[model samples]
Target: MAFSGITTKFTRSLVIKMAAILKDRCLRRIFKKIDFVRKPLRLNFVTDNGQHSIDKLLVANRGEIACRVMETAKKLGIRTVAVFSDVDEQSKHVKMADEAYHIGPALARESYLKMDKIIDVAKRSQAQAIHPGYGFLSEKPEFAELCFKENVIFVGPPSSAIRDMGIKSTSKKIMSDAGVPIIKGYHGNDQSNERLKAEAEKIGYPIMLKAVRGGGGKGMRIVWKAEDFDDALESARRESLKSFNDDIMLVEKFVESPRHVEVQVFGDTFGNTVYLFERDCSVQRRHQKIIEEAPAPGISSEVRRKLGEAAVKAAKAVGYTGAGTVEFIMDKTHDFYFMEMNTRLQVEHPVTEMITGVDLVEWQLRIAAGERLPLLQSEIILNGYSFEARIYAEDPDNDFLPGAGPLVSLTTPLPSRLVRIETGVVQGDDVSVHYDPMIAKLVVWSKDRSSALRLLTHSLRQYNIVGLSTNLDFLINLSNHQEFRNGNVNTDFIQDYYNDLFPEKKSLSPDLLARASVYLILLEKRKQRKSFDDIISPWNLSSCFRVNSDLSRKISLNDGYSDVEILLSFENDDSFKIQIGDNVMKGFGNLEINGSQKLLKVTIDGVVSKLNVVEHNNTIYCFSMEGNYKVHRLIPSFIKSKCEAMNLGDAIAPMTGTIVKVNINNGQTVKEGDIVMIMEAMKMEHVICAPKDGLVENVYYAVGDTVERNSVLISYLKEDEKN
Candidate 1:
């Protein structure tokens, strides 16, 4: 019995030891798996190689850029602080920030460009970083250096990169050294008029004059002939002085067939870099881009590779970090020459993001926080095509002159995962003349270019804005242009296809006019019904109401160019017999109210048409697939006659601006096509010329005085009244 008990004890002990060994092996494997999956958590902004954390960020800019940065910062669990000017107190960015500080006045120089003030705000807000958006102090190396000295992070490239790239003369030298193709231009330190003239002569006529430190199409002009050199130089200088505080100019040979293409490049402090692909931004007016697309349709893979390599080389030459765009001007043969490098994020960066499916802003933050690049050159693949159409408060028919006013009624297409509307203003927001006139950026993406274009056109048609003129119609027309759709794009796309793009005068269709009339009548009835006690009120009738009898009333629809007279016989509130100048039509319409917006569903002779309608200040603005139409309820006969006859042939200011120079005085004789004065607005010069041969009756403004738009800057004396 004793021997058996001892054997049993030994067996139990062996089993226990085996179980312990198994548990030890399982723990070792689990720990090894965990070590394989886990990564070192570190932020770029942390000192000593990401040993600290960034708690708050301060945005030292305004408008869309400010809002854009905050969106990414919020997503990454970083609080954002905003600084606004007096004019931007109620801006979207200010409202979105966790905390906001008033920086300065409305003018950019006094507010957004005040680097010292911005730094002070950052310090006071206890922010660890300052994001200078594209404009203002974004490219200022001094600002970046100051941020570094203050021990605050600057969310852009190194100060050295900005300094070297911000100056065209310096960048050209660097790019040339880096084997990047450069246009033959005189980028020297000589600033004398004689020297500049000599350089221009050497470069030959048709030279492109650009400010050494200019951006956004400002301080740039094309001189077609030697005779225009002096004027062009002076104009470029004045604009550069106002915009960049630099008047030094560079002259280059103007490439007749130039297309603007830029490659988005990103880098990390660890010496890693990659290109996010290219964007074709050729469609422009006034040297500013209007439409941009990614992957640059129709380019050979060889050219794409060369462009990307050159851009990466350019970035490396300057030790560039963060997001920077290398702009190139490619000729007909796809031979590209380096134009300039933007040291900060570009305004059209979204197109590249859409095509790559990468969040550039997030990448910027991560890079700034000391993180390595989240992508590799081989991994950054261009997927489908994408396009970005910039919607601005400018008139395309009138030279795209920027305008500013209230966005009285604003509505956009239904938001979706594919379609994005990026804007800083909302309905009832005022487009201040103190800044850029861009309203929003309409972005669409699809599996191919054709599908993306179709979506863009459809979305444009659905966008409705009233109380101010917009480029919506022009964008729609451009999207439909054969050349644009075929990818035959260039910088002069607008100028080259002006006739086809603007088309001849268009007359509203009878169906559209009838729908407008019904829409207006229904809106009025709704207003009356709301004012009364009953929701179902029979008293709400058409303009010419009669009991049990059809009444006919005349209504006029004018779209700024022509007028259409419509006679509508109302059988009831929902049915009408309409006659538009000789064409008769019958329609039954009903209004469906959708939260202060009215959608009119009308069937004209069994054909259904749906339009989005907004009524404001006695004007009914109707938007449909056909297009948008505005009809004033009351257009007196006298006003129409007045528009036809120019009583005094006065030359009025086309837009609100400062009178830079008055070329004529009272009693001066002037002939048609003669320059009478020059006005500067939105950093652009507009020449006012005489309309007819007559004596100047009055000069209402002086050289340094501001004037309202359409103000009579000069009036011609009547024939019989001239002294």
Candidate 2:
């Protein structure tokens, strides 16, 4: 078809425009979704009248999970109601709720776990649904049953499913019957101590004692020796009863060096189930996960398929109809045995969401609203690698001892499209004794495992917290470990690489001395400037400033584990020199303000170092690329003498907790290493031992009495000052 030049030009232009339209980025993405993703997961499933069945949701719990749920609910245009204990009224979750109700006191038993109180609040607030965000009543069959009776939607599995999966013994039996591999153990109703001990011996030593209804590492103990079986059983039972309100116990052979791999599965009321993927939660302390990632590393696609199928099978066996995790213990060869199935959302659910690009909470809400599965198993694609490092207010050097304190300073890695900071508290908030010590869950993702891991460690370094010991440094070290980078991980990772992870502090570096000196000098000038009209005023100056000579002063600071001494000299405002041992350096520093974040940048002999600093209670925190260092100013002897004298030989409460057992009475003699008392704090027990062999002069707190941290629990008679 011959045509004029103008017609040819128009024809060519039209073809070009068509080609461009097909290649346009936005259109390309839409076509990709049509071909690959099929359809994006969304919440537009309204009823026939364009109304959601659940208009308001009452979160029957507290902490990060509660806040997380509220966020999703709000995104779906659902009003959220939060229930809090007295101590949690000021918590982040409470503030995020549309309406909040104070349930009871500080103890969880009297508050969050009071199903009746929560149900009452739900009905009073006219909440159409109750989303028990993990822990508390999330797995309680009675709570689900109560929600059903009250005609409110329970955003979890059916009560029967909860009853079946909530108990490990029942869940194990069901898994075994369903042809899922089960581990060797006794899951029968033999609660007698004698029977358990006999079972442990028969199953052989090195058995695991787990609460029948336990989750989150609560009520779990490892008995390595036959002699320790009874004690382990008793302790496990006590903790189980306190945590789950059920003292039933289950025994299983402790799988040595196995990886704790779990698959995230979602089910709907219409009998549809899909597995998102699997997460490796093998690196842990106290048998609780510290870091988790998905889809599990070093896993073959065939094995992955098998894992997903088995997890789906387990969910089907229980007729689960919500978000649930099927946990498995995988050996070195990838052979796996079914562990207990978490009846609700797992603590590490964020990782699954990251990899699958699906909001499990949103799925729960939709399913509870009578919606079917959003996508088929084949369409649910695993796109990337993801990791979740749980930041906790705990002392890693002290066996990861749980801590309760004010978060005086909290500077976290900024959350992005691929990064999430799952938390329920903020700076200046207290980590209460009546709850979990986890500060937040730092979730990050990338295209591959290595990049995701690098991102994870980088984020952890920026996760700075002050006012209490934390495991941030430990996590950073663990993430960068050689074996971990190579995908060599297991439940014994921490134990296997303990030395590399917890290395002793090296001699205080010159950089540290310079940083500390610079912080003190600038801080002093700032304080003096605030106190008076001019910072340079002669009367306002509190430094070693002199007109004729370079004035020097001896300064001391405690670096958490030891005392660090520095001889610092200065002549003018920016003139300063710091000396530690034979090492010496000169530096001038200034502070940079970015919103609420303060960066202390110091140039020592021309090399500039930027640091995030937090000053609180005489302690100066310096955060750098290397690590976070805390230097506490020592109290001078003059003022120290004015305060009440502390007995060096007294056994003090290491944390705020109730005394669970007192082994020594007044006037009783104790050996140097004897256990003086045991206190329960933050769901873990801390033992106070005799400082030295001496007579117990006083027992200040009895069993069941709560004591403040650092308070003397027992006074030991010193040899020099014996009564």
Candidate 3:
């Protein structure tokens, strides 16, 4: 201090170290006395000039959303760190990250939802920011506050915003005060069952019981009658606790013909907020959107402007920043109401990005860095229509029962400038039951709605997944449905067209039989050729020389219930004659190979078709326009007898899951269709019911116990056999 101009290097270093030490100690003391979750602890660790630059980021989630965020971060020249559970070590996200840290076991609560573990990983990886993807700790105010305490940027809104918008009652009151049309509901402090029942009755039957703290259909149930109120509330509470750690709920009037329309809004620290137009997520199943499109199809220009303006108002009211969606429910007449604001990016944000020609994730990163809004509301332009079909590993025909296993064969539509494929698994990766069943999202864009729908359906058909049942075919049907094509969609769209969507199976086509027969016969000869080891190949592969007839064999295919005999005759090396019953047809088939693609091109009579054929688990999967089919051949009696058979009167778990509730007790009489057990799998519940009237002979599983698929949960004695 006495001779600043003549200061030595040792003295300069000593002074700088003391300043840093004192700053750290002073900040810690101040933070300790503050309630981080309820206050603005937003501090810039990298810069103080209001704009921050991040060199590395940690993704605090898994699966497709995690991968989605990393892709954008990488594009921005930012290195990414991935935190994965044990099961996700081999996940696509882990493989794509610059560094990956194993957090915990397969369960999300023990891994992704553990704030301390994620924050620790970020610190260990030297990440400057944490991007909590759409789920997990994304909406938790505490997680955001924790990031604040650590001086790491949480790429989301402030904790105050998350708290204000996360609770339904708080958000409703805020929106109502802001002149946003709010739906009538009970948002009170009373938590007793009697109080909730009274509130629901006041709201009328068909009331919606929703978790106050979370979104995405978790802890949401519809009580259609007074008798169902208690059960629905309990179910909502259980799911709420598992997903959000909050069981507080609010009552709301269930809207009919409710069209789910949401507008994407973005903001920055500079107080600039804008709407990126709206997406129509009206077509949904299981209270979650399966397909989403933008901009919404039929709203008038005036209504569209109002919708966007209202969304901006909602975002601005909370001093929001980063990517957020303001969801609204609209009636048939286009009258809209505020639903809730998602405190993070939505699963359907791709539709918004497609139409806006902007990378929302990149926007989120820039905003978190204290940068100004990328584009103003007036500067933003709506480009075209886009649709996102969420491909899931679930049985669509089985009430959308979720399944888990290795994706023995997985292929997606080739990504292009106009088409995007968001996924986190590969051909050999397993889709564990510990996470969501969504396998990938197929996003397609076009200049108009009709063109986009066509592209969406075309892409859906191109997606071929084997080893497990999927919603690929169901998505195809949904995209091509007349009502959907006409933009006549609502939350009840799936229920309204159930019959058309899940129709009774039509008789197998002779054309398909002819093509399948040719492929099989050729496959057999190829195997025979392989056995010769390229020595006696021609003789064994060639048709047996015949004087007056061709070699024939009866190819019988049994689809579990019915049997169809296909008389296959080898006409030549590649040509075949397949006759079913009295109908006969000629076809030729060949396997065309290009890179990793295998296309089975076949001609039946004068018609030609190409099918994606995959052989997995002894089943030939044929995926085509008609639908996905499992080709099965009759097993020998001895082989069938060797397989273990399940008891006739036993109710079994539909998939590998934990038994959450066992409704049946030993020796207890129950009627047919009564729920025997409830299992939780793939983040949802499924009920196992009695097949007929019977007395429970034994209880095979109990609550909180995990069971494999087809494991008997309850063994029943038939009514006639009960003593």
Candidate 1 stretches with Cα past 4 Å from truth are 1-41, 44-52, 531-550, 559-563, 572-574, 637-646
Residue pairs with colliding backbones in model 3 are none
- Kindly report which residue pairs in candidate 1 clash with one another: 43-369, 44-369, 44-370, 45-369
Clash pairs detected, candidate 2: none
Give the per-residue lDDT digits (tens) of candidate 1, residues 366-459. 7888888866687666778888999999888889988889988898988675798888888888888778888899999898999999999999
Instruction: At residue 649, give the lDDT of candidate 1.
Output: 80
Per-residue lDDT of model 3, residues 4-118, tens digit only: 6547767888899999977755654454333111122232445434444488999998889989999988777789999889888889999899999999999888898999999
Q: What are the lDDT scores of the predictions, listed in order?
A: 0.85, 0.85, 0.84
How many clashes (backbone atoms < 3 Å, residues ≥3 apart in a chain or on different chains) does model 3 have? 0
Model 2's TM-score against the true structure? 0.90
Shift of residue 144 alpha carbon in model 1, Å: 0.7
